[model samples]
Target: AQSVTQPDARVTVSEGASLQLRCKYSYSGTPYLFWYVQYPRQGLQLLLKYYSGDPVVQGVNGFEAEFSKSNSSFHLRKASVHWSDSAVYFCVLSGNNYAQGLTFGLGTRVSVFP
Candidate 1:
């Protein structure tokens, strides 16, 4: 079984500032990792994902994430954030079995202030 943990429940950052959201995972084997964002009254949208190959994956809107198998972490990063970036970010882990579905973190609410 795979599980994800997001320590920060909420994160605040000033507009144009850099932001990083921490994510930790526990799994027996190599797993697929994903980052998703949910806007107000909207469904979750995929930001980026890592399955194999390069550890770094690019996402929408200048967002990117680096996957570290040794550290068991996949953290999301943004060089400069905007007020429109405010949303709930979720870290998801998927096991080898596709039918098992994905395990999601509690989510980190990001608030970008002007």
Candidate 2:
């Protein structure tokens, strides 16, 4: 089975500060990776996703993620954060097809301070 782990349960960053969220995934075969952010009262928004092409993919709102096959990691980064960026980020993993459904990490809560 595929699994994702988000080490940090919560992260606090100041406005305009660079942010990085760690995500480690375990899968027997090539997998699809995604990062979703959920605001206080909104649905999950797709931040970025990786399937096969580039190692690094750009996401919305200055967010980007890099997939490392050797390291089994897909880490998310932002050059600068804003107060409105505060939300819960989820690391999602899926098999080649969606037969097994998606595996999600516990989710990391981000708090951006002004």
Candidate 3:
């Protein structure tokens, strides 16, 4: 019954510009949310996560996201993006155990222009 949807298939942004990636989820109970970044030929790295407490969470490389219970959304934001930030961003969700594996969105490919 839990699922994720990333509306945008691809996003193009200029270097030093702000960026926002949309994510929406469907879950009945408490959900563990995550955003991962994967560079070319690289493994997925956790950018940020929202479990409980603060709705806003900061992540590596100046990235952050806010969780909204009402909208069922958790959108990633960056004040400034770099060319190196060009990678595939995936919005993921896990109910309890990481061992349970992950349910991921279609993924959003971010392209940072020079």
In lDDT terms, which candidate is top? 1
Model 2 lDDT vs. the true structure?
Answer: 0.96
Q: What does candidate 2's lDDT look like per residue over 1-114, in tens digits?
A: 789999999999999999999999999999899999999989999999999988999999999999999999999999999999999999999986577789999999999999
Query: Which has the better TM-score: candidate 1, or candidate 3?
Result: 1
TM-scores for all predictions: 0.97, 0.96, 0.95
Note the Cα lDDT for every prediction shown: 0.97, 0.96, 0.95
Residue lDDT tens for model 1, 34-112: 9999999999999999999999999999999999999999999999999999999999999988887999999999999
lDDT score of residue 68 within candidate 1? 95
The 10-residue segment with the lowest total lDDT in model 3: 94-103
Off by more than 4 A, model 2:
none
**In model 1, where is the ten-residue run with the lowest total lDDT?**
94-103
Which has the greatest TM-score?
A: 1
- Candidate 3 residues lying further than 4 Å off, grouped into runs, are 97-99
